[model samples]
Target: MRRSAEPDPSGEQAPHWWQRAVFYQVYVRSFADSDGDGVGDLEGIRSRLGYLELLGVDALWLTPFFRSPMADHGYDVADPRAVDPLFGDLAAFDRLVTDAHAHGIKVTIDVVPNHTSDQHAWFQEALAAAPGSRERARYLFRDGDQPPNNWVSVFGGPAWTRVPDGQWYLHLFTPQQPDLNWDNSEVRADLVETLRFWLDRGVDGFRIDVAHGMAKPAGLPDMPEYLRSVTGAQAHGVDDPRFDNDEVHEVHRLIRKVADEYPDTMAVGEIWVQTDTQFAKYVRQDELHLGFNFALVDADFDADAVRRAIDLSLEAVSRSAAPPTWTLSNHDVVRHVTRYGGSELGARRARAMALVQLALPGVVYLYNGEELGLPNVELPDWALQDPLWERSGHTDRGRDGARVPLPWEGTEPPFAFSEGTNTWLPIPPEWAGLTVERQLEDPDSMLSLYRQALELRKTHAGFSGTDIEWYGAPPGCFAYRRKGGGLICALNTSGAPVPLPPGEILLSSGPIPTTDLPPETAVWLI
Candidate 1:
């Protein structure tokens, strides 16, 4: 391994830092709790910047912490400019931003663009104004309350909610997150202003939420019934006229214009478009800098599936000459550990996949607690908080299972996540052995493996290129060499073991119990 090819994080010369950065996603309420308020806050994140610095991430993305009613847990922003009291006030956020920069970590916060909190001032005013008034025009308020068209909420209900005035407003998500009418110039202007507000406050960039659905088709129309059950802000969000329309490109272009005002600042979209071509549109030359391709996150832990994920992900980004972004899990989906199989085998695969992701030549995103190899917690019904839990009549388990608080240092429940027992979501009792403190002492632990891989990814010459050349391999196994960089990444997704390619080993997720790589294991070589 060599020293980083890039300049120091504090250096101002690396104008294209985003092209080579590795981002860690910080799920605010679950990352850490400095206030003992049973929730993770910006101050807690500031306190843990050293841990992240040592763990080797270039930057971090904090899920929304702005002023909000917490309807969608901060995604429903009441005021994008103000820090929410729940995550500490503006002063605390400022301190976190200052500290993070000092630690050489860039701060990218979530910006929800497609909708506004129903409790937002604009929405409140819209509710009181006459049907055709400017206030109402800020939103998609329609006449004839028979539930405007047949659109369904992504959270599983009617997208239209009638107000006292007898007109219905559209909300692609839960009614609490009312969809804004982007057709209105005021709506577009406010969003650009919002971007500048945070940029001027010294933040690095933004992770645009629902980045693909901001523009709806003109003349609201009916959608297929099947879309209702799958409609969401997650991976399945791209069907129908309500999402990924060509007009959305204009919205992104305007956003990119605002972001370009801040040097080195970039935007990554939560684009859920179904095809590589459609996904590429969001990352065109004048739009978002990156778009999350969830192929890796949605794939099963098998050789063919994993290969396809990598290929498709890269193809999509290549369409716009944009760099690929990789991740196996995030806030909206089941953790890969649990999704892989929920046992020792599952944990093994998760660790292996982490290397597969880091070995790629693009931005890599690790969700909070992912470094600790945390699995999803199956919460009791009474403890669930995701709106989808109730919105689907309790038939859908929702995302609470994956949002459990991170277990940091302790051996018990709050596990150093908080001083109190009221964490937003309960940590499983069995996670005692997987705490960061414990993993720090075990070289074979998942945490250590991640640190080593990241450290190598940052300094090794083998990780510099974006192109990959595949090598013929046994069934249930895959091997690929990085172009222009003499590095190889191999995986054993089968029940049996496979021999590693001939090269000096750079890293492996765990011990190679034999001459062959174990099942669910991945290795890096040069």
Candidate 2:
């Protein structure tokens, strides 16, 4: 069982640290570089610990850095227990965790339990073993030349690949990654051991990749309808059949049991189910500590869309002990700046949405470069490396645009991302004006807005409650007050100004008009 670090000193009940903590997702390759090796490494993360601390985030969710063939950029784990050499060895990871904790930032590493790299020892052994061997049973191996079912890979193409021995293996993602057979006891025990390996290393938690995908549906039936193998695939809901299988909950239950052994450790799942009830199931008392609902992330910048997204998000977790995790952007999707439509209007809406996200009742996840108001770049076809690029037959540009390395300073390519123009993904030269260095010098920049909001959200008495009450507002606008708390947040989605309600202005995403809230802006009040 988990041990409580802090006893209830005042006898007044409150939530866990993660319930109110602001988490910053650091896509390792794009974040920073200390080794001048073009790719960001664990050493790079340690060097930037102070920056994350000053940014006021309580936790840093580092994307996968495990040993891999880079087929999926660390998500295809060749060695789950070892750190990839590109990101340094286990020692470097340990130093990063220690330095981050010293700076009061918790570290949550990405854990991909759903599949293993085709090159993983287990998979390789399975490939060499006979069809009926125990090694073959550890993964989804089928005897026929045809795939077990018609399920397609998330990246694109057929989901199964035939081995030289004429057997098939399932991979919901790329062919480089083969799905593990969770019904196989060896696979289940291996995952538990992998969890223990990291927990014993002192990492605080895990951001489970494809957490809802660990279990394949019984009998492996083909989907009635085709769905894209991406974030939007979950829109098919309960009967989607490809993911969110009912048995996935048992996987989480086992994981939660393992997590409980380490006090204060958390497991946040990427549960992409559609309905509010479906979304809530992953975070029930015996499952995940938090389930990411992409309702707000996929919503448009319109008033009604934003309102409905929030309603569904809240309703999704209203019945669970776990809080909803909110994020406007992540590594997989297009950055919100470009998604909202680029330039001025896009920037305004992005900032406004940030205010809404930060003022919400639960956990908030900020993707790197978002505070810099970075727009997605239009990369050349040759520059695209997402597996989706190849799998989609070059029809899709893939996620290289949002995965560009962040610019810390300077005015050119690499932008201090590394010593030369050899960054893993090119950093846009135009980002010169949006570097963290430039933004810090300009107090009114997006970086300042986020910094101030995060600090206030952490320190102020106004942001004390979890409940929200809707306030009457004009069309194309929203106003909500925190129940039992002094804070109120209002956003004007209209093109024209809207009247402000009674309260002292605590913070605004942008400058406010003399007597009303300006268009495409959000304000916090008390």
Candidate 3:
């Protein structure tokens, strides 16, 4: 059957498929378990398509589901061509692509090109080959008594691990996940082949993981002094020549080539860069479709800070020839409901933040459970599965807290995730009361507010328009105007009531205090 073409609403064809899209990020292990084996699978995600459609997302960004040993979750791919048995096989994946498209929602899978699990056949072959052999050169292998460079792993240890055969392999993450040598033409070719394998399956696009780390400095020099403080002997910043090396562009070019071969296929990069200008480089005409903006994710919630991020993002996209994308929370970070605050006031602040995200001029990513106002689960160190926990001596407490299983049913035994006896991550007790079933029935629940916001976004041109004008607000307040076609929108993020300049209030959070905003309240004016 011929594939259906993507709809281009505006006359100027959309620069990238993801721009203007509302993406729901699914942490596969915790989404749903079809086999009742205590783990979420592709079929499980298929069952939730209706729920996603109801929430009004255009696409879904699923975390890695490839064959893996699970050391660093699915990021440590042992085989890029096949799905892990634990998650489901290739046939199941094809079914998911078919099901999601039928619902008008695109599907993008996570692709970890920076590294591979030690168990991967490529790595295993390199390990067995003689030093300096063609196969061994595909990976960074050094025969010296020490590592080739002073780079450190982000997981808090030396980035190079010595093989028993007197050679060292580089790893930007855990020792089990060795970094790939992008300088090798064979490695790049294989990666392209792997990508094409999926694209041919009707998958819409890919979310490239740790994309900036694909290249290492050619010189492989010792760690620089400026990076010492931040590195603490760990991985350097993405811009570090040894990290986001210029050679990384070649990787993108290859990905772009593959994406262009198929109609409507897109590629988004998870680039950890400081400035939007630097981030812009990742989305040029020949690079990725969207380079996610981490500025807001790391920004302090304040009028000035928020305004700066938005302005910077706009300026960056203007410089780039491609569209932009934005996200708040993901599986790797603290939940927004907890990061902002855990009280009723905190929930209100989170709502305001959501308004800004949805109103931004690019694609927006929504992490799972955000609609239910879920907070990070406070799990004990013993239950943590993230390698960060083991490497940091439990001080960092890894990402397990934010990755708890979803609460579909309110009951304790299954937690609505599965009828199985074991779940990948235990559901937090507090989340049971905030289950999907319970929230769906409560009109004042966060779920309902999210549904309404999305509904408004679809109907209100101001919500999805790219044209924006920043409006100055009093201390501790944020205001912005979005105008498109004939629609206008004004938003106030302030604690005290601020007089509206005469417009209808389309939506509001919390009560307005004395004609001003109460703490953690936001209002949309038309």
**Candidate 1 off by > 4 Å:** 1-15, 235-239
lDDT for every model?
Answer: 0.87, 0.87, 0.79
- Which sequence of candidate numbers ranks them by TM-score, best first? 2, 1, 3
Model 2 lowest lDDT segment of ten: 226-235
Predictions: Cα RMSD each: 3.5, 1.6, 2.4
Off-target runs (Cα >4 Å) in candidate 3 are 1-17, 225-239, 485-495
Model 1 scores what on Cα lDDT? Answer: 0.87
* Candidate 3, 329-366: lDDT as tens digits: 88888888888777665677788788777766678889
Q: Tell me the deviation in Å of residue 15 in model 3.
A: 6.5
For each candidate, what TM-score against the reference? 0.96, 0.97, 0.94
Q: Which ten residues in a row have the lowest lDDT in candidate 3?
A: 228-237
lDDT of 2 by residue, 1-526 (tens): 2345676789887577899899899999888887888998889888878888888899999999889999988889999999888888999998998889899999998989899999999998998899989999999988785778777877778888999889999988899999999899998898899999888888888988888798887789887553644422243556666788888898999899999999888999987776787778889999999988888888999888998999888888888888778998888888999999899889989999999999888999899999989989899887889998899888877788888998888888788877767998877777888988899899989999999999999988888888888998999999998886779999999889999988999999989858699999999999
Off-target runs (Cα >4 Å) in candidate 2 are 1-4, 12-14, 228-237
**lDDT at 160, model 1:** 90
